[model samples]
Target: MVVRTFGISVLVTIASLVVAFIYGSWEAVALCAILGVLEVSLSFDNAVINATVLEKMSEFWQKMFLTVGIIIAVFGMRLLFPLVVVWVTAGLNPVQAFDLALNPPAEGSGQESYEQILTDAHPQIAAFGGMFLFMLFLNFILAERETKWLSWFEKPLATIGKLDQLAVIIAGLSLTLVAEFLADDQHRATIMIAGVLGMITYIAVDGLGSLFHTEQLEEDHERDVASRAAGGPSTLVKATGKAAFFLFLYLEVLDASFSFDGVIGAFAITADPIIIALGLGFIGAMFVRSITVYLVRQGTLSDYRYLEHGAHWAIGALSVILFISIEYHINEIITGLVGVAFIGAAFLSSVVANRREERSDGDSTPKSGGGESPSEMATATD
Candidate 1:
């Protein structure tokens, strides 16, 4: 699988180069390379979190991730979703909006085209990213801890929640409303609030699952045992339903988080819808699928719990940064770099933690571990 993935990566690089050179759009190639690398680096925490959560999924669901999940990432987010955002935010009919995108009016002239409007409103995007950053921080910091809380209300608050899918839908709608009511200059805060609400909704559901009164796991040894015990071929039938649902939802959201940066970055490269849709669609979907596969087969995440936490935190940070850029008018490159830095720090911390554990054990090996090996981990799920 590793070799195959590497080969695909090489092929993609070559293909990107060929396409860029052929179209005489050396810029596209550079942008492709930049965006591709940015997605991977900034998304490491995403990969770890994805792998850890995906471990619970059934094979069919994992397959769905590679298929349906990709459609959401490459094509949906970069291509269709943005158009939807444009139409809803700007209140232009689809035909007119797309026409604007296709033939963006000249810069500084304030043309009628959607692309021109978007370009004219480009500072609005950065401002959105900035507000997104602060909103994310609020959700992470003020939203209360999910694992264990200091107060009693936390548990009741958690257990009363419904499906996480609802949260995504609501957040999407909230963004639409924000785009509707808020002016370009003032929308960053609105974007941030929407993002925070989205996260709060996700945690509300997942936290409810965690609050289900499972047996407490106290030690690494116990966790390792539970991890090993989770692996019965017989369990595959039951595991599929739970695992697939989580994996699908996870992939969908992760793709959205990833595209927040990619879509914005793509605008910097070129606003051509065809180019954006085609290039981003194929590339984003492909990499996300590849990432899902790596997590499934390798089981690397089973040994690295903190890594997933780091990724989520990084994602949380990126989301906030994106929201903030909406109003602050910061550069897109800086936003990407900040996210990349967060992921990088988390990754380095993971590597260090892994090495420290290895040294402590006098062996650079991780004993297979997870929540499934014992009744405790399984109970944690239930």
Candidate 2:
């Protein structure tokens, strides 16, 4: 199972490194390797979140995610998206933007390089990606769930979630405050517009998925009831057709939100778009996708219980970091470490919880001649 999951990523990593070496020299190879590791470290939470959504998708869509989705992620987000951002922000034509990326302005030339242009556009990017991720985190925490990892915090939030569009209200206020205080006069309006657009994008994509998913649930329930009456085995109701399409779209947008930081952060390592695409797009993305599949196939999220919670909380922290990054330069190392800390802490908590449950079950079990009580045995079996 491990090899089946990671074989492609391994092959791609080797190919990417070879390409990097051929493209430049051993220095390029080293930089590519470093960037690949950086992307994987920064995106572990992204893998966890992707697993939650991918597990619901049909096999065909899952295949598409690994195939067509990878293409989009590699070229579209890693390569073309940065070019497009440079074009829009710097008022350059397509050829000019592409040329600028390929032939960056020399340092001390008093001209803006591709990296500088992208960095200058950070306010807008931060506002957009930050709000999108913030909405995702808000929706996850605000929804009432059977399992709560941080009950002390999540319980009160869930209670307040009874108010309609409370997430939107809070997000709106947060965006307003950031725009007012963090953004300067020149970019204030841009940040506000971008943030609102981010909110709208999240609502549209997530709302469509929920609408179709609710219908799918009703249909599955009917099918399950009919199957039970006929005494046949019931099958899992995975999302397919239009429902899967929307979910796939949602996943891509989510990936884009996650990639915004990685793409920008890559400039700190290298200005070459080719290297970034090879390292981040090919190598990092493949492994992240593999990890997502492995988690789904292994039922890691179900077994750990709080793994998903940790991922979402990490996302919440990343969103805040993005907003903070607009005004201050945040080191990528800090962002990566914060996510790892959350996931590690949650994994430890899950281990402790599992042991406690086991002990409780052992204590409640019948001993000696009593054997096992039928009800207790049934509960244990479940």
Candidate 3:
């Protein structure tokens, strides 16, 4: 797995650099490398989080993840998603937007100016951020209640399967409508709509998954219902495959959550559609792949027990920040930094406690005799 991941990364790096060079070397190269490191660092926890879901998947799905999923992430989501968002927000044709993003007023000032203009022109990113946070909050709560408890009381919670995809689609349309209808009215309503829409989307998708899910392709409700036959419990029974699909949707939402800040931040850096696409796109996809690889290879979810917990907490915090950005913008640096700090503190505490326990144990060894050794007795007495 490690070797394969590394090989994939190398191939991607080469291909991305080729694109970057075709665009021009300096900014693209620098941006790619920087975003590479930044993404790698920011998404380390994402890999571990994904592993928990990925392990349960069938080999075919896993293979699809490595092949088709990466393409969606790299070409579709990472590259095109931003440009599409920018085009929609800026109200420019793709050609103009691409050109504007690619070529700005000054050489050194290309990045900053473009970002400022994008921010000024669009103003909907705040909506995306806010919406992402709200969706995540719902997701985490639903995930928590359902996973940690299986009682009948929690049965209603199982219906939460609908919220993941709902968030993004709602966020997209809400922002689009806000940019359109409520241009100057109650600005906050946009956030509310986005939030509610995201929630509904999640519910719709996951609920459908639960209601119509099946392990066998032919046994599914889509098939059985089409045949006009009442299928048994096995027809709608949720398998890890369905869960994996939702989990993939959940991860995409999470990626969008992280990218919401980074996307907006791209304006802060450079808005060259090609630059953004080639640079941030490369880095983001690479990091996502690297993260998935790390989790699979290192088995961090198994090894670093608290890493997943920490990241989910960070995701939860980020979710709040996203919602709050509707009224009070949260800086991305602060968001990532605070998350790192919280997790770092937790990690350090774990390490320190581990070392202290090890030391105490070392000093409390039993002697050959049935009675405790002097050191052991002294340590015990102390």
Q: Which number leads on lDDT?
A: 2
lDDT of each: 0.56, 0.93, 0.58
Q: Candidate 2 residues 239-336, lDDT tens each?
A: 98888889999999999999999999999999999999999999999999999999999999999999999999999999999999989999999999
Superposed Cα RMSD, model 2: 3.1
Candidate structures ordered by lDDT, highest first: 2, 3, 1
lDDT of 1: 0.56
Supply the global lDDT for candidate 3: 0.58
Model 2 CA deviation exceeding 4 Å by range: 370-382
TM-score of 2: 0.95
Query: Which sections of candidate 3 miss by over 4 Å?
Result: 1-3, 103-124, 134-186, 205-243, 327-330, 349-382
Error of 1 at 113 (Å): 4.3
lDDT of 3 by residue, 263-337 (tens): 666555556666566555566666566667667667655554455556656666665555455445566667667
How many residue pairs clash (N, CA or C atoms closer than 3 angstroms) in each of the candidate models, in the order given?
39, 0, 11
Q: Pick the candidate with the highest TM-score.
A: 2
